[model samples]
Target chain A: MASNTSDLRSPLARARGLGSAKDGTEHWWGQRLSAMALVPLTIWFVFGVIRHLGADYTAFHAWMKSPFSAVMMILTAVVTFHHAHAGLQVVIEDYVHVEWQKLALLIAVKFLSFALAAACVLAVAKIFIGA
Target chain B: MANGSGRPLSPHLQVYKLPLTAILSITHRITGVGLAVGTLLLTWWLVAAAVSPEAFARAQGFIGSGFGLLLMFGWSAALYYHLCNGIRHLVWDAGKSFELSDADRNNRIVLGAAAALTVLTWIVGLAVW
Candidate 1:
């Protein structure tokens, strides 16, 4: 390996960490934001599930139509997927070593999570609009 | 440590008799990964419900089946545990819960509560269904 004598970058910097985004803690804040949102949204979802237990298609459709439920569902899907993407990106960065592979996987995770969330939101919106 | 101190906490991992807290920490990460993957079921069900009566029924049949129930049992347990531990993490993020004994106690509590919640949810779920 070729060494650069002119390379003034501190060894401490190399040993201690990887590249910093330098833009601030956007990722961390975004994650916490989503988490706080989920606390209430998740609770609502579970309770709603219990309430609608043994419900058939019409019941579910009706449940989905309520403006309160429809809006909450959209928020839940968007925030959950945003949160999941951020968390998974961190995990992949921490574990995956190969540079290209890591890049590929991160992009794929971003794409997949967003796509799925969009689909879910669209489904919820359809029910809302139909009613 | 210091740069020359042979890496911070290297001896601690080796020296600790049993790192129960450490184990729980890793399990938190694993369960997070599992839940992320398992969320495909949620997506499928929502899409099916939006698509048509037939599609929704097909989704229902799969989830209500024995194999699907088993998967749900595992995923639901993972969900509860992850949620419990995740709240613990958020607490720690607020600069609390640092005492070693308290940390251990809370870890146990998180695990216990998750198990109880999972069982209770399923019991009610099955009973209702």
Candidate 2:
């Protein structure tokens, strides 16, 4: 019976494919990709911010309405938020060991980031379209 | 494993000596959080700019203040730090930094580049004004 038990367990475990948490590589890759995307986007963003330094509303509107600035602004928002989501995801996984809390935080981060990214894109679209 | 079997092991952070790489690791995390918060500020500015002249004025007023400028400066520094450190990580990922000396050199490079970038950004910012 003991031999049979061992044999049964071995096959079941092998079949189940139970293993160490293997999802980390995906998160790591995601963070890296987002970081890479942010490099150019961030440089553009910094320049955009600097240009707005002393400008008033009229200047701000004209800047955002420009095609190149509008496109870069949209890219910056999307990439920045995506990168933020990836980073915060890892943070939650690292510190929040409680299963339920970790799940909730992960979901909340995803939802909030998506909402912000979408809002920024829409706002930019509206500006370009004069809506 | 045999000694003090019932007691739990001390946490990782408390147990380890803080090395340069470890410090950079934590700073990477810190700057990431900072960038996330700063992104919200950017979003607010974009929304205001898109909405109306009054809204844009409000954003400009807040951003032009001393405190706002300070926060912006900090955000820019965080962005540059995270960028440099992230590239360091990518290099490490490609299996180039196994040697202790190489790791130390890369750490120094990342730190120095981040500082230089921050200074240059501020210089340009001030020049713009």
Best by DockQ: 2
Per-residue accuracy of model 1 over A14-126 as CA lDDT, tens digit each: 55544465545678889888887887887787777677654667888999999999898888788888988988999999999999999999999999999999999999999
iRMS (Å) per candidate: 1.4, 1.2
Q: What DockQ does each candidate score versus the true complex, computed on alpha carbons?
A: 0.48, 0.70
DockQ of 1: 0.48
Off by over 4 Å in 2: A1-26, B1-17
- The CA lDDT of each predicted structure is 0.84, 0.84
Pairs with steric clashes in candidate 1:
none
Angstrom error at residue B74, model 2:
1.3
Kindly list the per-residue Cα lDDT of model 2 for residues B32-100, writing each as its tens digit: 988898878777887887788888788888888999889988988888999898888778788888799
lDDT, residue A17, candidate 1: 47
Model 2 residue B86 CA deviation (Å) reads 0.7
**Once all C-alphas are superposed, what RMSD does model 1 give against the true structure?**
7.5
